[model samples]
Target: MLRPYREVLARPGALAFSSAGVLARLPMSMVGIAIVLAVPEVYGSYGLAGQITAVYVIVHSIAAPLLAHLVDRHGQARVMMPALRVAGLGIVGIILAIATAAHPGWVFAGAVVAGASIGSVGALVRARWSYILRDPAAIHTAYSLESALDEFVFIVGPVVATVLATSVAPTAGLWLPAAAVLLGGWMLLSQRATEPPVVRREAGASGGSSLRSGGMVVLTLVFAAVGSIFGATDVSTVAFADELGSKKAAGTVLAVFALGSMLSGLGYGLRHWQSPLWRRFAIGVVALACGVSLFFVVSSLPVLAAVMFVTGFTIAPTIVNGNGLVTSFVRPDQLTTGLAWVGTALGVGVSIGSAAAGAAVDQQGAHGGFLVVAASAAVAVVATFVALPTLRAGHAPAGRGAGPADYATVVPNSDPSA
Candidate 1:
């Protein structure tokens, strides 16, 4: 299991980029909660904090693909470095506004600005791996590692943010993430050795709308539904802990969730499999729905934590396969943008889910949010099958139906010229 990852990281520049990527991506997990926690301290309302966080995510969903497109047309360091700086400044502005007791409106505006500028570093990290690792199996392991890193970041980020906010100051939460982004962004950009070369879109290679190509539209919708599970679960967990008179337990519970995901992701990468990508994706979706349903009945904290750990088992596999599907559907030059669309869809879903689940929590308590989780998973399951005809066309050439030796050369509809 570790052999593949070991070999891949042994490649020159891989460790540097991977380490930097982990640091940069850590902010993704921190910022939402940091804002949610910090804003309430100033405004005295979780409602305002939630709205600000929603604006941040919604704007990010809209802007990430555009920034990623620029990265594809230009270069990762060129585009991403400036984006990181702008994002840092926006966070600083928000901190300053909150310190000065500026209106919530200013905070919302700052969030939007930050959201627009914080590029999808996770997607770019995967794109870099796609460029550097040509072997299909190696790519699989690399993606799994990346997914595990995501789980790790989520585990670390919330705990760190919560600690800083509770033990230090509310401002510390946002300030620390800003500093993290700057440091990580600089480190990532400085390691120019592993960056993917810019692939300019040729004349007539505008390739129409990417959303129309190879069922990307359907896949993105699936991602949106899946993302809802994440958003609902996070908020519900915190609410659950609060109800139990142990608010800090929320972080530990959530960490269990991430632990399950991270371990499963690592286990998933340890071997290659012959199962069809879509089939595995379908199973993962079903498992997630069933797993999350367990939360609906749990009344005790121990039971909830255990259920959450088990429930997290399917997330990474689902995400890994979903990303694989994206790679098969777009041109190499469009990879970053294509991944960004999936991330955007997820972000949009997170905003929607968090808002809806928060309302549900207010009305019916934490467990009520489980309804949203199960429902969203069901929606994703439905979308997967509904999009099957289109996906079958797109996945056939490189997926289960293809010869093993063909895996390296198979492009599906990914190459516009082909």
Candidate 2:
């Protein structure tokens, strides 16, 4: 389990930056939990809060790529600091708006600004990994590590978010995430080791430029489905929990879902065997779809948790394979934009899923939300299966750039010794 990402595990700086990204992302859960708990608790209306949440998500969907492009054009450090400051101010503004019981319009506006400015450390850190890991084989391993990181963030972030929102004054808890994002992102900026975008120069040159390539399209779709699964399910679970008058279980349920993914990822990493990449990814999609549909049947928290756990199993491997395919076609230059595509897909999907599900559940109820989530997963499963035959199977190792750790040793080549 630890072996694939063993190298990242060894690097304090790499791990630190990754952790910083996690800390930066931690507020996502807090935002969701806070909106769900606080707005409803204060206003006595989940429906209104859900609508506001939808607007917040839409802002994130629109803004992620713009930020990523800036990161690519400027330095990640250069783009991140201002974003962090903006996001921080937005958080404070949100608290003040909510504290004063400001009009719903004010709350929605604040949320839009906050979500839009929420620095995309995920893109930056993954780009950084592309450089730090260096070799293709290591890159796959690094991708696996990143997949695990997402699962980890999903598991822990929500739990902490919920605890703070429910236990601490909602405003106090807000500061934790705001302060954390500033500290962590700034710390990452200070690190000279973080990777920047690769600039395309002639055929084999490097500098800094935003470029996109072949596998990126597929990656975006894959992440869109993955992100939708989480977003849809979070809302579905919330609707399901609400059916029984229990909202506290929302975070616990998500945490269990992450736990399942974590275990699967560990097992996936340890296995020397990986399926044909597309097939592996398709299988995960199908599994996720089936699992999402099963959420409709969950009537209680325990059953919901179990369903989430079971469904979570396929999350990491799908990401590992999807992103591994991305690295396969990405050029040395334009690496950040290539990666940004994946992040963009994720951002868009999450926003759509959350917003759609929130609205769906508000109007139609929990079962309807599950159906939507399942349908999204099914789209990936069916599309991937259709494309499966024409595409390659399994994650064959390939070197991304000039490096010792690249897939050179594993993938077939004319000079096996090269």
Q: Determine which window of 10 residues in candidate 2 has minimal summed lDDT.
A: 407-416
- Which residue runs of candidate 1 sit more than 4 Å off their true CA positions? 204-206, 396-418
Q: Which parts of model 2 are misplaced by more than 4 Å?
A: 1-4, 41-45, 103-105, 197-214, 245-247, 271-276, 297-301, 355-365, 389-418
Which candidate wins on lDDT?
1
**lDDT measured at residue 239 in model 1 versus the true structure, 0 to 100:** 88
Q: Model 1 over residues 1-418: C-alpha lDDT tens digits?
A: 3898899899899989999989888779988889878888888998788778878888888899999888776778778898999999888888887878798788988898899999898898888888788777788788888999999999999889888887888877888778878999999877776777666444544455568685688889988988887888877888888998998788898899889999988888888867777777778888988898788788888988999899788989888888877777877777889889998898888777777788889998887787777777788788888988887678744532222133223222234332
List model 2 lDDT by residue over 1-418, tens digit each.
Answer: 3666666557657877777777776676567656766786667798887777777667776677777666554566666788887887777777787778888777788788788888467667777787666555566666666677777876776566667777986555566767877787777767765545323234334343333333455557667877887778877887777787887667678789888888777667655444455566667777777887777766778988887788788788777766656655555334555666776677678767877787788788988898778777787676666656434532234534334223112121222221
